[model samples]
Target: MNKYFNIAIVTALSVAITSFKGNAMSDLSQYVDPFIGVDGGGNVFPGPCVPFGMVKVGPDCGGKDWNAGWDRDGNIHGFSNVHVSGTGGGCKYGNVLFAPITGNLDMQDYSSPRNNEHVALGLYEVDLKRYGTSARLTALQRSAMHEYTFPASDDSKIIIDLGSFLSSHERQYLVGSEVRIISDKEIEGYTRVRGGWNIGEPYTVYFYAVFDTPSDDCGTWKSHRVEPGKREQYDTSEPTGAYFSYRTSDKQKVTVKVGISYLSTGKARMNLSEMNSWNFDEVRAACVSRWNEILNKIEVKGSDEQKKIFYTALYHSYLQPVDKTGENSKWISDEPYYDDYYCIWDTFRATHPLFTLLTPSKQVDMLRSLLDIYRYEGYAPDARSGDDNGRVQGGSNVDILFTDAYVKGLKGIDYELALEAMIKNAEVSPGDDERKEGRGGISDYNEKGFVSTKFERAGTRTMEYANCDYAIATLARGLKEKEIAQKYMERSRNWQNLWNPDVESLGFKGFVWPRYSDGSWWSENDYSVFQGGTWPDFVYETFSWELSFYVPHDVNALIEKCGGKEQFTRRLDTYFSHEKWDQRWYMGLFQISNEPGFLTPTLYNYVGRPDKTAEVVRKTLKERYNTTKEGIPGNDDSGSMSSWYVFHALGFYPNTGQDLYLISSPTFEEAVIHLENGRDLSIKAKKASDKNIYVQSVKLNGEPLDACSFKHTDIANGGTLEFVMGSKPSKWGTVGVENQL
Candidate 1:
């Protein structure tokens, strides 16, 4: 039972446990609940996407709201082909919408009441109330297949609206657009959207749409006029496009296969080659198979709800750093091209490491993609979408992501080129042309040893820069570049510059505070009430108090600086105790809601007390997550929060920029991590249950593994890690492990 229990039995059991209405070969994809993050601030797009595929075809709510597409209460406004899952603010990329109707053009607002929806890994369907039509959808790598069932009527029509965007931000970004009917069954177009995080860079997405059956009467339209026999349409007054009216029987299905590309309309046509046929059922089945193949990488044997939560998180995890390199890639290289990196600031903590564990091959391609971006654009992108860089969030943190991949020994990337990009990004400041590219305050950080309060997000920036420097140094050491390693390793300690040792409040000394360029502490105001609003003098999205514990690469050094183990323990206790655990405000103090405070709960493992870590981890698991529509605590942040849950549930967490995993009490009795290297790492907990949440002892390969942690290499090599569970905290993992870092 310690091993993977044979593939035949697993397959047989999987087939037995699932029975769906459609022709789905595997049932694993069914466990993924698309609604998990819809209500929560998870902000995830519950759409049809094949793994990291670009085209996320799903419905957008009518009107304008922050939830982008498909808010729980908002009316359904048809399906669109592009979206950013789990992000903050009003971002771009919900282009080219197609809505089906069966009535006269009396009401243009097809904001129908949604009902009887079926959402799977790569499938979505919802009944539109007013028209009594059902919209079923699926997708390929870069294409969307929509099958809209209409009632018996002569006015049955398919509307291709180019200006139907997800939010007002996307609409504002629309510079220009063009649509043309190629033939009776074919149409081609492009939309150019700028700003909305892309600044002045306009993103032109080309599309090729083909209908299965030709319409009886087809014509193009712009603004409010229905242009009969007009073959072409350009930018008009308001949200413009065309409509195809058809005489139909009851339950008539109008199918359309649409392909999108950032390169050209030809590339979009090339992408549509994956469809091969107009069989909607076949496409949906194929999508289900592909999703199952990816989701079954990690198999768990838990309750139905647990499996739902686990698979939903797993689904969210693969939503991005989308694979832009396909058969019809925009770039002229064999190396993989990945785009829509919402921001490494959110994902560098856990999401990237989750990829290392489950999809190392993809991780390699992602690293190569970053390097490729550097090769073409002259600087690595921060929050990129639709083939353009967005606004820079924090420090140049792609260095940390690259470093994480390199240390984990993921292959296929050019290390020399990666090292060059990392060093260049760290040392050089971006020119005016590339404002959101390389490190911004590098000059001040290098000279003054800290970004002053004068700079935006000064405290968080200093800590993030230090972490990035540490990662670069680690990569340099791996490549045997001794000089580069030494240079960056020294610079990595610059986080110490922000420590305000004189602040002794609430029995806790040595708080990290903001400082002036003249080396004086900017400690005149209160930081606990949150900054950057009326004050306009604080870090980004977080308080300095929360940002203080962010020294991930060198927590031991942080512990020593904060007056050793006793005082450090007191501060950690105070941080957690000060705030009441609310899922909404996971941003407040030990904010598990976001990335800034991810490593706080596990800090106890470093201070020779794994029991406290166990307590907090269990409490968070119990309180924070569920199987509700609003399951996730906050913004999934492109799966960062979901990945955080996945790792913690499986009983380990990757220390960012390092190869080590800090172990804790796992939620499941047994979990088999199917490694991409053709191996399986099984974790079995004896007497595991809700009550038995404390680890009594741990054994790696039947040996007493006294260390409360293990290296990434240990799991990759394959073995069983058995943890004995108890109802109460014991002496297990209390003393600590030497040289673990």
Candidate 2:
């Protein structure tokens, strides 16, 4: 670890430890460093939120377009009420902003040199140095509590902006808005915007704001002050809002609660009713308790730095697919409502499986939400924000998410309806409706067994659809729906059609290459410039060679395609040999920063080379991840990367949607996962250290397990998995036996 990381870890440990000084003991949330990904490509918003809560309350530094809200190098624009956690494109949510000022209005945006900044799970606080003010934030499921302390001044004012929703690629505007001064101490209003992450998705956010101490003066402003004590209705698309100037004596702390709802202002008020009093400490404590309940699901014995990374990773994992069930009981049925799936393409790989181990009940509700959305909206939602579905990536990938939950034996969902949704998506062509509900080029995929370059990113789309097909088939077979299983199972092999046995560019036989509608190759000279900069869109942010290894459901078949095991091993060696990363290519052959490349490290286990898997996984974690602001190599993608780290650090990975978890040498001495089934799965990496990054041998419940993989039941049923670690790789888990798919 570097000096900054050491300082960060020690400081985090000190806070977590010192929090227990006056109190009897401490909780895991204390060690969470929300700032780890703020500066890094992690692109994570450090803010106040409960686990899967609908509200993400945080500061929006207003970095031109990047979303995560807070930027280490940017100025503090104002604190916004909502944010999409760890996403790439432009920022989303962040409507209903509140900023504090003293004395003059100071129309100039404050350059907040952040000080005394501390953030844990469910809580965030920062001192605005320029304004000499402090802001602290905590959240409820649908509401947020903000406490601001201003210097002794009578001019302390709180400004509420109803116009600026988070900046996006397509700038969002307040098409219509209404502000009502409900009373001397309360106000209720709402704003409507049409453009967010899903460019044309309409979103209307309602908020009910209340103050502990009534303001002496209140007025409405649009670019400038307009009226006082009057309910204002603004129909034009312009910057509009209200401000409450307080009459404070000295260091008067004011507490404010804002409840948000997608339903109506009444629902927002009801959401705010949960905070019965103006007790900031009480609300803060309650937020801490809620976070602890979730973070305590896992316990690990490791260095303070390791613990910080693990706990923070877990914290980031639970920040999305927020529960919007409380939005309005009337608009949505009694079924669960989850908003901001953001993108299922980024999440299904690890986030869903991690939920299976930790919170299976939430997974069931989330599945129910997907089904409900499908029943009402004619299709399951993929990358959604608020209530609208945006352009999807990777071919109706929600099939993979729903199927992953169902196959895990989770209850309380309409499985038949879910399967219906999956099949409907699989069969329906994309152009059948203007909304683009199902798979694009599905007709072509079904007829030709492969998608042609006629559609953009044909290679990426084909592989993603095949994976979804495999997941659906697996669920269908388990449910004894053999006809559905057989149909989709045949479709799952469509990836084989995209394989070109003679790819001169890759200097190998049988690599996945794009072809035109007539089965002619669409060749590009430099495959390294696959996407990103200085490259035409050859692939969707991935090299054809990297995606060629994307047959997750049937890696054995992929091995066969590469001319058996020996040649496959040589290819794997060549893939990892390139240590240099070009700007055109985000990362090298094993793009640890991206999702398609996540499962590549685990491919070694299939070739009876679990040692190589162990080596690669350990090195990736050590070099690519850390406990700093610039920690992650790329966007966290709503905790997909974080969950990837959490599982790998525990010495296992859910390499696919299936139940099998590939094992490796854990970075921790011991890690314990407390499953929802009231069982404790303990992973003991004995003699584990930084130098000891290889698995010498393994045992499950005192029985020698020779295979490199274990069933999900092994963890869910819960028992001890012990691994003897060594400085170098051992023969353990290197057996040639492979699990039949």
Candidate 3:
């Protein structure tokens, strides 16, 4: 009998297993806890949304820290129709709010304490303590359905706040807004706002809402004053909203459907066709079914806690870089258009690679969307939201994203056009608008072979740009452009320009140090191992020790620079074992909370120490992650962090912009990844447990594997990777270490 079946039997004896709607007990959505990352800095939206849906309808609490518009302990402000999931930094998209109340309208005091909250895939319900009402939220692709059950009152009303939005630490100003009541049952409005993560860039959101029944009275409000029976209100810089008052009996239920669009109110109204009826449960069931379709791509047999974390991570991974296929207002194209990348600097490591395995078609569409953005917008954005791009953290990491897809043979993208865009990022600087797109300080990088101290984040940008150049070189070689390929291949070594063999830290020599434009290094007195501060610093969100291990394309060179295999392995050990030194979020020198350190734990494979890699990865997976409100160690970074967990839990981690997966210990007994080519890539670990965590042996399709790595082609067409586990580390993948190098 299968180990999973045996475990299931044992679990069933101890607990009751409820079947989902008389279907198979294995409904994947049941394992997804939407509230897992709501606390900590995870900033995950715990509400109702389908896979990559534009309408992330959820309750918005007032605070600078609610980047995704929902906080665990915060009171309910209102349910907004637009939100980003698992993102940090500046807040965006809490627009077109609908708040239900049973008494006099108080714009400032309408927020209610919420309790009995329940969040699942495609459903969110919470009882508002102030109004004694229950709000249930569900969503379609571009619209939302809200059902509010209220207490008996003659003044029951639903307030449509056109000016309300999730404010961030950055300055957020409402440019203008308008609300027009078409009937007692209907209203249409729009809000134009600027300044969030997009950094002063303006975007407009138009909404059309309809109630299930006509109201007894209707009006509009500007700031604090309410004009009863008013049909229209237009204002700038002040709060504006519309209200529909109704006389309600005890436990009267009211339903509202809201559709939103970036183009115009007409399009918003047309988008409402996605949910034609007022059957909230029916729409919610459909959303749940859609979620199941995606989550079913990967099936795992593990403990219920393991299954919950895995499925929830999978669910969060598909939630963004949203599918705005027909919603683009900038340019019309038959190709798909996606926005809210929130930034590729974060997602390129793991999230996009996971998409390539599970949904290649959608991945292709997103790649094509990046190309489309480059076609009209001059360059593809590194960080995009609200139909605009503002921040560029690190290199034009989109180069890596495009190359990762190209190397994996994901079709439908114009690779030649993509190369052109990549070259633009390599060769040209975006000048004053460099923060929005393309490489900043490219003139210096192309001329000096390294970004220098004159530029902010010089050391980190140089390393990331080198990696981006490697991506360009790889793509160019695939396209048969020998000259371009060779040129970029040489430029990809620019990271070495910053390598100073004299700089020492934590008993390890030769760190990548900051340098000046004139080929001089920052003095030792001014530099520390953890020198860099956030944003406008020599490195972004990380220090020199962590950024030193970010060279994924040329690990051998990195190993050689660290004084060969033994020294590199010792350095990694020190990195993992060092005492906590500062207030930064890290374990030793490994900052599991950030993206820069994601690949560090797996770097041990290069030194033929797969055992150490397994040790660190399994330890991190156990200690740093959980299925709680504060589950994630850091901001999920639009599912980048969650995808990192998902990949590692399945016994592999992708080297982005390359076709490699480094082997790690499997958390589950078995995991089956359903490929896009109508095949299943199954991974099984025998005698795998908390104690039996080291791989004693591994076989690919019944053949013994010597190396701790596998190429994408190995499982592209589907195969079985079986691992024999043991309590003690063995030299299973230690032979033929040179092959890995």
For TM-score, the strongest prediction is: 3
What TM-score would you give candidate 3 relative to the actual structure? Answer: 0.95
Clashing residue pairs, backbone N/CA/C < 3 A, model 3: none
Best by lDDT: 3
Ranked by TM-score, top first: 3, 1, 2
Off by over 4 Å in 2: 1-26, 106-115, 223-225, 234-238, 328-330, 432-436, 505-507, 524-538, 583-587, 736-740
lDDT string, candidate 2, 594-662, tens digits: 787888888898988888888888888888788888787688989999999998999988855676888
lDDT of each: 0.78, 0.77, 0.86
Those runs of model 1 whose alpha carbons end farther than 4 Å from true positions after fitting are 1-26, 63-68, 106-108, 168-172, 198-200, 235-239, 326-331, 433-435, 526-537, 580-584, 737-741
Worst 10 residues of 1 by lDDT: 1-10
Candidate 2 lDDT score at position 114: 70
Question: Model 3, residue 233: displacement in angstroms?
Answer: 1.4
TM-scores for all candidates: the values are 0.93, 0.93, 0.95
